[model samples]
Target: MDMGIEINTRFGRLGINTTDALIDIKSRMPVVEARSKPPRVRIDTQHVQVSIDQKQCFAEVGLKPADVFAKEMAQKSRSKGLKAIADIARKGDTLARVDKNPNAIPALAKGVMGKRLDYTVAALPRSRPRVSFSGGVDINWDMGYVQLRAATSRPEITATRAGVDVYILQKAAVDIKYTRDGFDTTI
Candidate 1:
């Protein structure tokens, strides 16, 4: 006449405090049936941190040719203004056929060549000397200081029931350190 049963929730803490059972005098109840324990191997370890920063400076500027075109009068597409007056009337009389006005010289070559040409930079391209100084002064303040480290070790499960090899889960050894700050600047 012996029986035991004790279970705690949250998927843990279970103690039947077994004394082995066998009591069934026709149906007194105690045939033994209490086995619920197979879930215990929780290991979690993870830590990661990273930081990177790189700043560079160097410049030279001088550009001047501000014609940025715009003479207006650019209207060509009556089949290219009649194919440029039919190639200047087959190369012999187009000033609008000597001024009879077939739209006079393609309206003066679409007013001297179809306008709209831009280049406005005759005085604003000046940054030729900042010489590195954004955490790398003159080029070596940890030239873009970068550090990366990672660790995730704890996963080596080995188990054998009868061939003489109990159980083992040991694998934790991974440490890394890297740093590069300054002197390799190419902008």
Candidate 2:
């Protein structure tokens, strides 16, 4: 009971007539678009300095130069890793061109948005702690939250970096039909 129209073009010769009936089609469909957030890095120093209203005297506590170096290395690793991921995601999105090539959509979903985006950590120096990007979708889309964070059970500082996200919108479509005298179309 499936029916369709066949139109001929330079690619090949074809024919369409009343026997080949056009079936019900979409007036509109959802198109997906993506926006990316900039990569980020963070550090938490567990010390707070207090100051008086008028004046305050500063005091020094024990310092660990190695810890400072480690922090810098960790931040650098995270920032660079995220930046690389964002670039890859951008490339994948561009290649997908979801509006034009539907076939590329699945590749974009699996390669850029999945664990592949988190590959930078494997090459980072040992001083940096591992980070992971976990994804989730919500039935109520507005309530969804996506983020990146440390991969440890007990992280001193919880970090969140926003990555690219895709959403959909409906668009109008055109319908075509033929009459005995001529053709009619509506948008």
Candidate 3:
């Protein structure tokens, strides 16, 4: 007696799906600003001034005596004897005298005869005129300055991860057959 057996098999298959990663980035640059101011200046000035005084000079020139005779007469008027004689003559002598003799010597009186005679003498002034002068100047200044400002922003980024999916499309299978004396026995 002879026995035989035969078998058939089929393998399973799988399917897969994949996805790629993605990234996005955004950036911003820094900014700067500056400002400046100019300096300021100011100036002040006063003009020169002058003043002159000539009152004393003019009075000295106008009141000076003309000659030595007038100066001597002015000095004799202040003597005590001359002043007493003048007083006595004014009080007692009122008659006029006539000179009939030609041989009488001329009399010289040592005194001022004028009723209006100035005795006070003015002092002489300096050769140069009196002068005064004044002047001034002032200056002011202000310093300059500068201002600066700066700003910056952070960067932004976005990202995505990769992913994969798998699934079975078919399952494994097997078939068996037996034969006895060349005749099929099992199916």
Which RMSD does model 3 reach against the true structure?
12.4
Candidate 2 similarity to native, TM-score? 0.19
Model 3: ten consecutive residues of lowest lDDT:
102-111
Measured on C-alpha atoms, candidate 3 has an lDDT of 0.68
The 10-residue segment of model 2 with minimum total lDDT is 53-62
Error of 3 at 160 (Å): 0.4
Ranking by lDDT: 3, 2, 1
Task: Point to the candidate with the largest lDDT.
Answer: 3
Off by over 4 Å in 3: 1-4, 38-146, 177-187
What lDDT tens digits, residue by residue, belong to model 2 across residues 141-170? 233344554333332444444444433344
Q: Pick the candidate with the highest TM-score.
A: 3
Backbone collisions counted per model: 7, 0, 0
| TM-score, every prediction | 0.15, 0.19, 0.34
Task: Give lDDT tens digits, candidate 1, residues 145-172.
Answer: 3344444344445543333333334433
Cα shift from native, residue 137, model 3 (Å) = 13
TM-score-better candidate, 2 vs 3: 3
